[model samples]
Target: MSSSPQPEAELAKLRFTLEAANAAMWDIDLVANTVVWSENAEQVLGLRPGALSTTFVAEPEWIHPEDRAGTLTALWEAARGGETYVIEHRIVTADGETRWVTARGGAVLDDDGSPARVVGVLVDITDRQLLAERLRGELAAKDRFLTTIGHELRTPLTAILGFSAELHDRLSDEELAPVRDIAQIITQQADQMVALIDDLLVAGRDADSPVPIDPHQVELCGTVRRVIDGWPDEHRGSVSIDEGPVRAFADPIRLRQIVRNLIDNAIRYGGPTITVRCWETPIEGRSHLVVIDDGPGIPSTPPEPDTGVHPTGIGLAVSRRLAERMGGSLSYEHVDGTTRFELELPLEA
Candidate 1:
């Protein structure tokens, strides 16, 4: 038979184990008005274990000023009630570094059910707390970016649309044609800019607003035809939309913008013939809308611009942003000397 451990031997063993563990251990004797802490406590709190001899009460001064009173009050209540106490708080080390820690304890009761002692464990949670704070900051930044872009784009777009409409209404037949062309170009460019701004906003907001989209049921073919019809015949080049209408549940306006931007970019950078195809395929229980184009093809790397804007690259970026917002993705592939742009939006059932 194994012999039972004496009280002193058992306590000594516990002290040894606590000293070896990473966590800090503390014990307070209520009646004796004294306190003892393991060596690890000094490392955790930046205080020598034996430096404070009067009482453990002053040790709470190391806690963050904002949390010290509340923590002490809670612990006192738990001790008075002969119950367990658990709390997490911030403390300042001797070097003045703030660290997060979780402390848990239970009251040790006398034979008469009166509280005589309190024992507790303290663990550093600084790393986990910092990570959580960083994530919150990132989310707030994204929200701010979306709101700012929306406000900025609306101002310029309103002016362009209003002036173009007024010019179209005021010009005479002889004077109208040239003025009309100018107004139309202004309107088209303004619309494109607004669409790009919206896409950027969408990308920033997507995490919070993921909506189910159905690409198979959306009238994609008609949307493409309409966009092409809006372009002048000279700049229109060879445009083709497959015979069948493909349906998708993506925001109709955003989808149209994606198609228009791609086709516009192809005409601006590629040869006259621009082919647009829309189709749906199921992938892992979701549907996708794919738009391909045969353009001069995106450069292996983005070009270094010396002066003017590179509309093709800008348009592709906008399209990708929109696709991501609609719970989808956009990608490019070059095959057989043709550059293909694919926009994939999740299908809404």
Candidate 2:
């Protein structure tokens, strides 16, 4: 058999290899209260190796003031339990730059099985911490942007609707004909703006919690009729609704907004006649509210604002957003030269 190596010589080799590694290494003698740290510790803790007589002296002193208490508490708990210490916290470097670090360590036992020393390793995690913070900031900015757009759009829309109503009330029959047409156009555009604002608000809210609305128990048919009645008789396209009272549990106002947007978009971009069909079907233990429109279909390519000319408006985008907020979906396809827009909402129980 080969001769066994001396224990002291073998330990020295292991220590040398650990010191050469990049990670910060440390040891604390519990009885003597003395501490030893590798040269790499300076890079992690901003302190020279062996700078302080005791590890506790070097702690709180170099650690970020805000993190000192929590870090000490965790470290002390691990030490008392005779277990490894593992923690991540912010630290101030030698040059006064803040960074994040992860530390892992364990207790060393004496011959009597009592805790004698604690040793550990540390790794820098500053880059990963910064990246997480950046993502959170970006999400907050998006929410603020949506809220601002809704507020701004609502102001102009309210003014347009109020003024149009006033004009409709004051004009004489002969004078009212032309004024009524102008008022109708204003009202239509105002309604479109309102729908857009509602979509933004609902999308922001739904980002937090989503709940399904019942479409079979709500008054959807009445809401559709009211929207059609608001349109001007001359300029309004011929609208037909199949007979029957359709009920859905969705927000009545939001449902009306979706239908109004689809119908308005059809008239603006497609033909003069707009047909709305409401029907319910059971699929996999759930009822669905289907609204189909025969209009110019959505282009396979995504809609662009400055496309010069197209048979689609932003209303489709708003409708899709509203449908999703109510836990439904909107889809479009073309069949036999007719562009069809479909809104599917969950039917009431």
Collision count for each candidate, in order: 12, 8
lDDT of 2 by residue, 325-349 (tens): 6767888777776767777776754
Candidate 1 structure quality by residue, lDDT tens digits, 25-68: 88899998888876567776766555444476754667899999
The 10 consecutive residues of candidate 1 with the worst lDDT sum are 207-216
Q: For this target, which candidate reaches the highest lDDT against the unseen true structure?
A: 1
lDDT of every predicted structure (CA atoms): 0.72, 0.69
Q: What RMSD does each model have against the real structure? A: 10.5, 8.4
Native-referenced Cα lDDT, model 2: 0.69
Residue 232 in model 1: shift from native, Å? 3.6
As a whole number from 0 to 100, the lDDT of residue 114 in candidate 2 is 81
TM for every model, in the order presented, reads: 0.56, 0.57
Alpha-carbon runs more than 4 Å astray in model 2: 1-125, 138-142, 145-149, 199-217, 234-237, 282-296, 303-311
